[model samples]
Target: MDKRLSDYIKKVVTEHGVTSTLKMKLLLEVFLRQSIFVNTSLPPKHNKRFWPSLKDIYNHVAAQFLKLRDSCVDQKLVVEMVEEQRSLHKGERFYIRIKKDQEPGKFTDENFGMTKTEQSMKLVNILWEWPRMDLPINKGTGNIQGYNIATLFAKDIKTKLKEILELEEGDKRCYEPHWRHLQWIDRNDLTDHNVMNNSVKGMEERNKLFHEERWAEMSALVLEEFGLFKPKTIIGLFSPPGYYLSLKNCNNGKLMATLEDETGQRLNEGVRYFKDVLLVEARIIIASVVKNITYREAEELLYPLK
Candidate 1:
């Protein structure tokens, strides 16, 4: 990995903590490409339309990364790319406020005459500016492809998860929605329909592509952060009634987490070998009770140890 890339990873992790592979990959791709992909349903800034498919974007970035591996791409360009990607990946969730006279749907060269509904729709899209992860339509549940997105907010994953788990009693431990933002779209908007008609299929494919490409970047970031990084074990945490901590040894060359019970007893029930393969594939690791730490901490600790 490039030093600049490694530094950027550290900076993000420092700002956010343990980042998901998806987030990291998106960051790298953005930094390298200087282009950001956003759903037309949302608007933030002005950028030219680029990729037709998420796969196309990934392939282009991956190829670009490879080409620059030894050739030394411009660091300034890489930095700008990173900034642009960050903007897109974590763009603001504002909506456009359609004026009273403006239409509520998409205004075109033919129908630039906007209606109330069209104005409202455009305003909402303009405010939203980017595809939000909060909508049921954009969740990991209805994955048309065999791919899902995982995001980790550093402030939450490491510190808040345990706290949230502890705060809820029984299965009724209600928590706030963890996604970044909710995207609002007017079902009545013609622009939205046009966007969907033109981009939905490609959107799904691009989602998968972004998900995969981000993981690749994440894995590389992890290795750069902690070379030969591997989790010793992992433990699972469930609640009372049948709540128990399950621990499993992951010496089998896989990233695993150890869950500890309230009494600190390690069970053999959580993510075992080949179980948390996605974590390893994405170079994500969890902390264990024994170390009272996470894989991210271990990786960072190694930096000083060496």
Candidate 2:
């Protein structure tokens, strides 16, 4: 490995005591696994994983996924609307997330597209440092090309991870007790270069394509922030007034972050995630969110009504 890469791994894993961040997990998957697919394996430094009993599995599937199943419409229009929202926000400077069902009286258009809220900037600056930093992707190939990382794809990873960790059965989030171990990602996400549901691409690809210079500027911002500021805590990035939820894990500098306010609480202390664990989680998040289905309702999205 290049010395730079080696040093980064150590800095994140050993020096800082942060075993996993959004980008670090993706980087390991691309190289070690040679593919950006579903992953649930954790770093050896962490404790051994556990499995959910049959009841736990059933309950987990019901709590996290079944709700989406019951609510999901699984129509092409839903995907299109989501795509449109993503496209509209593709150019903003900071990360954004997609959310609905706003708490009554809490929703406001005033901050709908604001770029520099105090909480958002705090989270954004957190992202510019260690575990919370941007993804480790190669931008040489345009995002349209298959295999290159995408912004939405990375955001979905966090979405999936948050969902999986909330599961009653999942433990350390790796290896089989059974099919549940693969909960972070799924078979549907295996496609390459799928920027959207009907559009078709890999699990970690982004929908919003930015100009090269803008991409360069965002990527560079991380280094500049890191050189000057001290790293912040990597936990609990959600804010209550409603957020765009962009994780910014990839090189393109798009959305990447937690799904709900409680997601930050789910990060298991001492958990050290690597390539396989995070990739799988990414797949599941994409499937659940963009596909508009729970695990059971995935069939509806896969074969929607006419």
| Predicted candidate 2 versus true structure: per-residue lDDT over 160-277, tens digit per residue | 4444433433332222221232333221121221122243332113323333433333333322222122112332211212343222223211111222123322332101121223
Candidate 1 local lDDT, 1-306, one digit each (tens): 444555555566444432234345556556545522233332222322321233333333344344433221233234445656777878655343333453543322221334544533332332223443233233223211232323332322323432322221122111112110010001011222223324545444334333534433333232222222122233222111122222222232111222332222222122221112222222222222223556445323221111
**Candidate 2, after superposition: displacement of residue 282 in Å?**
18
Cα-based TM-score, every candidate: 0.18, 0.20
**Model number with the top TM-score:** 2
Which regions of candidate 1 are displaced past 4 Å? 35-233, 236-306
Candidate 2: segments with Cα more than 4 A from true spot = 1-8, 11-23, 34-117, 121-263, 266-306
Clashes (backbone N, CA, C under 3 Å), per candidate, total 39, 37
After aligning candidate 1 to the native by TM-score, how far in Å is the CA of 256 from where it should be? 14
Model 1 whole-model lDDT (C-alpha atoms): 0.31
